[model samples]
Target: MKSVMIKNKYWDIAADIYYPPGFSEDKKYAAIISAHPIGSCKEQTSGEVYGAALAEAGFVVIAFDASYQGASGGEPRYIEDPTQRVEDFRVVTDYLMTLPYVDENRIGVLGICGGGGYAINASMTERRIKAVGTITGANYGRLMREGFSGFDPISAMEAMAAQRTAEVRGEQLRVDDLLPSSPEEARSLGLVETDLMGATEYYRSDRGRKPNGVNRSMFSHQAAAVGWDAFHLAEVLLTQPLLVVVGDKVGAFGAYRDGCEIIGRAASKNKKLVELQGWSHYDLYDKPEPVGMALEKLIPFYKENL
Candidate 1:
């Protein structure tokens, strides 16, 4: 894997490129843009895990950090705007197309967790992306309304309104932890769900922890999610081949339901949904068994489609 930077508007997106075994400069190869989840970075699950795995499977892959977070440049860090999130995929695709060894027509995308929803949403309008896949797909917009545990809708709205206003007045910006500092604290807070528990463990501990994966975000920016929907218009515009891989575990995050909704709505005639029974949402993040199970299907899906 080699680290590189891709231009996005006025800033740069930090990313790592993983070349397939015996890669060649003279040969054009299928490429994939692997996006990490919200509050995660390229070096963790996306770059080192799935990105490396997919590259070894013969596809050149690039794993990148989202803008406004994780080594990427943007003002007022930790903004999770849904619109811009989808656009980030386009920036990555443009950079991928520039490489002489990357086949422009055979590019694909795979996103994990929240990145999954963004991937599907981006693929809807990004015709250059020939195929799409999601593992434990999460719709951040749906999550804010239906699954978010941090704040009730009414309070979240009021808080965001207040914070955004306060920031404009030169008050200190408000940033909050995306999860408890540890699993023990999570359990004490009654966050007993598997996804929540695993999130605290994974993000806060060495299990999946990294410095750039700070697991926090600006408090006011979350308001963008309340009114957004990742699957918006997918039924009409999502024509690329689609694949959704998710665990059977149902939890607060709603990845399973989001996966089902996208599969039912996507216009892709060649789509498929594979369930890894008994694996929870976080299991697909870095766990070998489930990741292996997911890649088994993903490797072939991209291979055949791209």
Candidate 2:
């Protein structure tokens, strides 16, 4: 593995390129770009787990930090703009095409968590991406507009409106934790044993914590994300082969349902949904069993389609 940087109009993306064992520059190899979840860095689950795992499976892989987050450059840090995130995928694709050891025609993408949704949105128009795969795919817009059980939209909208107004009035950006800071805090907030608890354990614990992986994100990000749909025009525009993976045990607001929705709406005749039994949304991030299960299917799917 080697560190590399790709310059985009908005920022220079920090990335790591993982070479397959015994790789040679003389031969072109199929490549995959792995994207981390929102408010995460490349060194987190996406790069440390799936990127390395896929490289070991004989594919060149690149994992990158999203612009305005982690090591990537941009102003007003931690902004989670879905449109810009999708464009980041395209810019990475452009970088891959320039590599001498990468097979331009066989490039694929793998996105974890919110990155999955961004991958789907990117694949719609970026036909150069021949194959796309998503793990625990989440549509941030849907989540922001409608909470887990679809009961918090009004309150959520009101909060967002208040925040936007504050931003317009020149208030400092408000940053909030994406999940509770601790298991006890989660329970206190009535999130015990739910997906939020699992997420807190992963992001706030030794299991997956990294310095740049701080759970905080800007409140203004919601303004941009609330209206963006990852599956917009997926029925007519997403012709590339798609693979959506989710844990069978994932609960409400989990990407399992989003995966199903994508499969139902996508025009691709070659799409498939694979579920990892007994796994939760966060379990797939770095847990050996679930990550292994995911790669078993992902390796062949990209091989066959890319």
Cα-based lDDT for every prediction:
0.90, 0.87
Q: Number of clashing pairs, model 1?
A: 0
Q: Between which residue pairs do clashes occur in model 2?
A: none
Model 1 pairs whose backbones collide: none
lDDT for model 1, please: 0.90
Ten contiguous residues minimizing lDDT sum, candidate 1: 145-154
Candidate maximizing TM-score: 1
Write one digit per residue (lDDT tens) for candidate 2, span 122-231.
Answer: 99999899999999989878887777315576666578789878988998778777778877788888987657787888888888999888766777556677778999
Q: What is the C-alpha lDDT profile of model 1 across 7-41, one tens digit per residue?
A: 89988888999999999999999999999998899
Tell me the deviation in Å of residue 219 in model 1. 1.2
Model 2 lDDT, residue 115, Cα = 92
Judged by whole-model lDDT over C-alpha atoms, candidate 2 comes out at: 0.87
